[model samples]
Target: MSTTYLNLARKWRSKNFDQIIGQQLSVRMIKNSLYLNHFFPVYLLAGQRGCGKTTTARVFAAAINCANLDAFQKNPRLTSLPCLSCESCKAMEQGNHPDFIEMDAASHTGVDNVRQIIEAASLLPLLGKKKVYLIDEAHMLSKAAFNAFLKILEEPPSSVLFMLATTDDQKIIDTVRSRCFQLFFRAIAQNDLRGLLVEICQKEEIGYDEQGLQLLIRETGGSARDALNLLEQVRFSSDQITEENVLRVLGCISDDQICTVLYHVFSKAKSPQKLIEYVDEIKLESFAPEIVWHRFIVALKIAVWYKYGVSSTGLVLTNDLKASIEAVPLSQAVRLFDFACQQEQLFLKTIDKHLFLSMFWIRLWSMVHNQEAEITSLVTSKSMVTASIDSKLTVTDQLVATSEQQRVTISANSSLWEMFLEQITQVDDQLIVSLFTQAKLKNYDTESNKLEVSFHKKFELFQDLFTKKDAPWFLLLQEVFGNGIQLNPVFESESIVQDVKPIEKKVVDQSKKQFYQSNNSANVSKKDIPLDISDKTAWAMTHALLERFPGTVTEFKEETDE
Candidate 1:
């Protein structure tokens, strides 16, 4: 004779409030309500999936209709409200109680189904003192169905109790929600989950590794049902549940593989070919792309935490892996983390996940390499500037040397500001480049390391863009200038232009007119025209643009009043 096998998840389902893990507050509240006999007409239980919302509803339903409920209510301290020995408790436990109705709102999400529930709720109990209705996934009910339930919920029968369980309570209509007493359930704590797994392993005589169990808990994301289901799968896959077996069962890439990828990502060597080869190897292993990507994201998070000197107790890192993670700067690690997070949805949506991941790896490699080159260049330039400053310093007077150093530092900052402006044109976004170009460098204060940029009153939008801390342009400013440097955005007053001297304005207007006339005249010689300060600045800007873009000037049509 062969006996049938039951999965751990179903076999270990919570039978009572005390048996429900990770929901002490909800259990206690329900127990207290039962003890006081102060039941709400309707109750709303909401939480994440596998966090025991539906299970709590079942337990609460049984407790209310239990034949021995009066005994617990009188005692005030007895937690076993539903004496499972009675006929009512036995019927509920076997899922055959006539008075206890469990409706799946996901399937019967219609007005007619709700009408049937309302009609039945009006009838008296057949097997117990009170009739209990458990509506699972109550948020799945259609809007019309929720409206149909409003009247019955607001004026429910004295002997009828309605319990609604939902993973997302926000979708439930406000009218229905207003009538229900809400109880929220939180995810199981890691320690509580660990203890539950330990007890299950002991009871089932399953051999396991502590690290492997921790990995399971991490993957389950505080879902008890998922944890038990995964545990059963791992148990049957191997004689002993170890980290390697768990990884195999989960179809997740191993930690060593994840570390290898991180090493290539953060290492100084440009090894795109090796990274692609490794990705191909991962694909050959038949690992799930989503799981692989998720593991990579998790590894990046751990690397970021390590980079910031925050120790993660869950992860056990080898010395080499720790060294590799520690070698990466916090900024680079955070960028990689953000990139991985953004790519997750795209990776899952693509049909050819391996191809997408290969491209992703290449892009990530390019980003790291580019950032490394930029940092190296910045460091080299700073060293050269420092050498020049030291070479010019005199040893005769200490105060004079200090003053000279300050002047050189200020000069270097001015050169850095120019470099920043030149680099802005290289950005891929033309709109951002145009906005940045409109900003004038008004002042640079070395004392506060502040760069005050003034925008014309007409460019208020550009000024607002730079003021936002999360804006990409603002972040780029900090990246070019040191993190300590601050940006002060000033908007020039509309009337400020009226303060300019008439003579100076006339000279500027005359210089601009001559410059345009010279460009438009074919008979004029360029050398014969003397250049003013404004003309010199324009020529300098044009030469810089030509040097950076390396293009011929095909057209030079000046703007005119048409």
Candidate 2:
């Protein structure tokens, strides 16, 4: 019945042509039409969500009505500021206005609805100069409805005006869209969003850090509505907004953490399966893999650009990208960037991201091999740096190892490639046994320190699931092999373990804390083990903690904690 002090979104809703941000092209065209005093039969506004197409149309309608907003208190209308004293504006505000109609195409998508509206359009405006029709989510209109709307658009009545808003224009029938003057709405940028959020926070007297605002802007992905909602959540949680709160509330992974993981995974030879381990966690947070992957490619591109001293503020690269590009090499950085782009294309078009990732790692390892090849070929063929080459090889060999014992000891020096191999050979060998049985290891290079395998499946998850860190098998591996040591499990025939334990667990009256099977196999719970951090999940987590977080994990198996 009444208006409340407008929230950030409504309070700052665009008033006129100049108020809308980052939509210069749309604004210019619309304003020119208004100034020229020429009106299209139908005006279609299309783009991604929260881009303010509806606001502009409202403003245009209000201006036409010469609506005064002051009469309605805080509820201001853009047209003539929507005259509150006028019966027409009052009716419109009440949504009972005969002259102003708001139709949600999503609900009224039937042809009958379009026919009714068209029939109404034949008559003159009862309370205003021009009858205004605002159809939201126009893409939802049915085929017959679209045909009716199209015929109307193709031969629109002079007294009627139409504004169609949609998040996706492609879904709208081409013939319907063709008759309307189309204006595209784009996602607002981070900086603009930051400034907007700051202004709103100040207006609302909500305290927030610039960093918090920045995070909200980034996490909201330039949707004004989403950003405002997040800002409101921050305000409600605490007057003071912190980065921690932003991450927890928005479930946004910081650029730093994402980059750290990206660097470790993309720079060196690591399995894409490792990335997938976090996918479910991310999905639970409502994060899209396609978006995250695209964002990562942007980060890699920025890193590449930074290495070359050429900065590119490209699309998909977020606000945190520039800082991440520091200290990277041009060729490798660019290679990774290109790889990310290629990977994104594959992920978007085909579900075969696993193969794309495996190929990527193989290619990166090739670079190291190529480095050695270049040196050796230069030394032998050109007779140019044989001594230097020999010395480098000596160091590499040392780094490579002291003996086969040390060479394949499940250490972190195996470039992640060999680390994976070590797990299968000396460790559980069960998971890899399955993969190797099914996989065709077409190539293995001692010098390159890489392995190539192929699978018949088209989806990436086949390879990813087999080696994901959260997978039950991963817990088993981390318990056996450690962290930083990757395990790229390719799918193969299931490793048939015939080494049956001599125990069968039969239900017996409880006497012992643990039960022994007929095969002499013991199935013990964590209770049987010492306060036993014996669960595979917990064990894997502990190892990860020790690796990723150093000083915090000081000592392992501290006498009592178990």
Candidate 3:
């Protein structure tokens, strides 16, 4: 009542049946019903909040009660379009129309209100052509209220109509819902939001930056009223809205802060305290922990998308992630995103809220430095890998002793590739040995040191077993003695293995350099990769130390927001 010009949400409110956005779908069904003469006494509009269910129901009430809907009845779409110039439309808009009765179920939420409303349904139209009952927040109605009202709604007077609106459809008793025609409204789209904001600015006579408008739309996440209210706040302080101003007003973290944390994650920083402290500093800038967590989640998701050669424009992301993320590896970024999302869900659903935030930072740390601080301890626990001479997997033989050196020879005498078959049989007999199976070597490249191996479709079982990354453990000749060499483990989409290529000089010297490179995820750098181990003595030394210095991880600070 105090404002001069109507804001966008009010000024642009649907005047007719067709003007409603994200709800044209619900309008069509009502129009079709009107055209076919299949009139229902009550209609239920249901969806999440800020999704146009209540708004569309209001427009529907006006349409059916339009005083000037004379010749438009043939084309039902025109029949329900209200003429606001008339007494009935003007009265409905002001919530004073005798025929257009609006009720807030939250206030009139008992059996007594329902009994009175049902008794009023017996009367004919008091002012408009038809009486319309608009019930908002219908889910809040008590069971006694719904049970009492259901009778009149299911079989109402011919002149009476009922419209129920609710954010949660599940809370509405099933008996009441089944009697009424239902319509579902969806969330507004980002592009739809952009046009809505620009239209609002032009109508309100407010000057704003396009980037600032983008920030408003991104921040609102599909709620038009919320976005316009944010715009109103920005206009109060300054005529021209800047990106920085919007971030400040919204208590949003900046792109610089997002990038700062990301750099630590990528560098495999061990100090979890540093990341937590950085987040705490942002809190002094008045940013909420939830928002800080959201920014990181958005940054991580964008990084993953960028790595996949995809663009994040128009995607749902925090504005703080605008230019900070775009070049991280897809695999690593996705891994981080998954970790962030898991934490986010926990933060939302858990009573242990403090642990939620702690887990968030720890997850990022663990992505790079997840294993125990000592390499020897981690390898020894698995028993799958052993420490080599100096905890280096550049070469090792936990599978066999150096003394069991049986030089392998491939005789070029059989069409079936006898040498390859023998190697596969030896490996398969042992359950732990997984690698290349009963297939011909096909060809070998000594110059490039690449083995050109192929598996046919008919031999699917053999192909799966033979081409697996774990195949090398079985002493497959190509993997074990490729060009007179032992290979470091190689990780591929199809397999994980240590490829060994021996030196061309001497057998004695080549065996001495037999190294294994045990790998996990490969998107990380060598230094960031977990150090591999093979010998038992080093692991024993490190485990003892870790036990002596038992590490305890606790929350660096109590949660700021309850």
Clashes per model (N, Cα, C within 3 A)? 0, 18, 25
lDDT of 3 at 199: 74
Q: What is the C-alpha local distance difference test score of candidate 3?
A: 0.63
Those runs of model 1 whose alpha carbons end farther than 4 Å from true positions after fitting are 1-5, 280-285, 317-329, 371-562
TM values, all candidates: 0.68, 0.55, 0.60
- Kindly list the per-residue Cα lDDT of model 3 for residues 191-274, writing each as its tens digit: 787787777678778888878888787888777667777887888878876777788788887767666766555543235556
Better of 1 and 2 by TM-score: 1
In terms of lDDT, the best-performing candidate is 1
Q: In candidate 2, how many Å is residue 286 off? A: 12
Local distance difference test values of all predictions, in order:
0.77, 0.61, 0.63
TM-score top scorer: 1
Clashes of 1: 0
lDDT of 2 by residue, 352-432 (tens): 553444455445433423333323333355333544556445665555443433333222233333334444554333434
Model 1 compared with the native: what TM-score?
Answer: 0.68
Residue 545 lDDT in model 2?
45
Model 2, residue 60: distance off in Å is 1.1
